[model samples]
Target: MDLPQSQLVAAHVQECNFVQIIEGLVDSSHLGFLHIDTLRKSDSSDLAYAQNVNSMQHALAPKIGVEDTAFGFYYAALRDIRKEGESRLQARVAGFIAPFTVLNPNGDLHQLVIPMTDTRSMFIHVYSASRRRSTRSRYAVSTCGWWAWTARHCSDFT
Candidate 1:
């Protein structure tokens, strides 16, 4: 859904909040460590995961081309899952930490973190996706698991 541009502009003007900077620090390498235990054992980082990343990068390079600059890391690795089929699905825990926006600028099923203040933050995350399930179903199952995982491991965030 498109945010009414007017609302975004208003938020920027009112000092309700301004400026959102997104940093992409996690990659396949980091995923292995960050999600190893949290994710299902079959989904953990391994030779399969690296190959998946490489395959995705290769597929996306032709369509979107490759951007090899400072801003490019964010766009890197756009995989084509159709080739992989239904064996295992890969998902990113992405987040949009914004000053005011409630919904993620990037759809659901990725980790979305919104920071309200320096020390305090609100996190909305998507845990997984499945070809077998509808969007709503995938989100419900994944979100619950994600919330439970975060509550147990991420004490600092609380």
Candidate 2:
């Protein structure tokens, strides 16, 4: 909740409906499958991100649990993790804020899918980290790569 340090990355997707983007955001099941290459290449040194990707990779099918809230709803993708010969359950929870905002399971990431037109949308990714820990370098590299990829493939969607 306390995000003193923040960065925003926005991408324009042509010929894509905002609702479609939101649906994709809320579907945790596709993360490992869709981004398997990225996940497989994740650096183990990158604690948080790597751990999340590892969990996702190990559990392709997670049990989904949803709960309604006044603003919108929150959902959890429950996965199994094995460590030290012991098995445990890991729950990755994310929330759908009313309108078009989504609170990612990481807690620091928030996404907004805004409609620019009936067939176009602006996808904004907000990375908000605590002041105690700086994510400047990581954020910069990630956004730069994302922008480059978007620039190269954006036309495909049109």
Candidate 3:
């Protein structure tokens, strides 16, 4: 399946090794705590990404399960959702493609970590939408807030 609409949302040099970037990508537990303020302030009605952020905030200690894939590995962050007195489980699965690529659970976002030197790496974020969807729509930009937050807070990001 080819995505007709795509954007290179962010390309920045991070003051970290590629391995460190990859480690951060696979660690889902950090999302709730590290981005608690932004996630809490997020408009949950905006898009699936916002909703997912809200979910992460609600469930900080999600059960993580990992499986080895042919190329690398995939992991699922399972969280318990209680709504209207009913309980359900929400699983967000993401993949780590060797040697430094992360596949977001939504399947539309991807992060690539390219090593620049011994202690530096290039971090790239890409967002893509299918032909049936408009790239300018809110859905495509759902994660822009997170990227913006990173850019604002990380001095090394540019």
State which candidate has the highest TM-score: 3
What's model 2's overall lDDT? Answer: 0.69
Task: For each candidate, give its TM-score against the true structure.
Answer: 0.31, 0.73, 0.74
User: Candidate 2 vs. truth: CA RMSD?
Assistant: 5.7
lDDT of 3 by residue, 101-148 (tens): 999887777999888787767777777744223222322222323222
Scored by CA lDDT, what does every candidate get?
0.31, 0.69, 0.71
Candidate 2 or 1, higher TM-score: 2
Residue 64, model 1: Cα distance from true site in angstroms:
16
Candidate 1, pairs of clashing residues: 56-79, 93-111, 94-111, 95-111, 95-112
Model 3, C-alpha of 63: deviation from truth (Å): 0.8
Q: Give model 1's TM-score versus the native structure.
A: 0.31
How well is each residue in 59-108 modelled by candidate 2, as lDDT tens digits?
78999999999999999899997756888898988899989999988777
Look at candidate 3 and give me any clashing residue pairs: none
Judged by whole-model lDDT over C-alpha atoms, candidate 3 comes out at 0.71
User: What's the candidate order when arranged by decreasing TM-score?
Assistant: 3, 2, 1
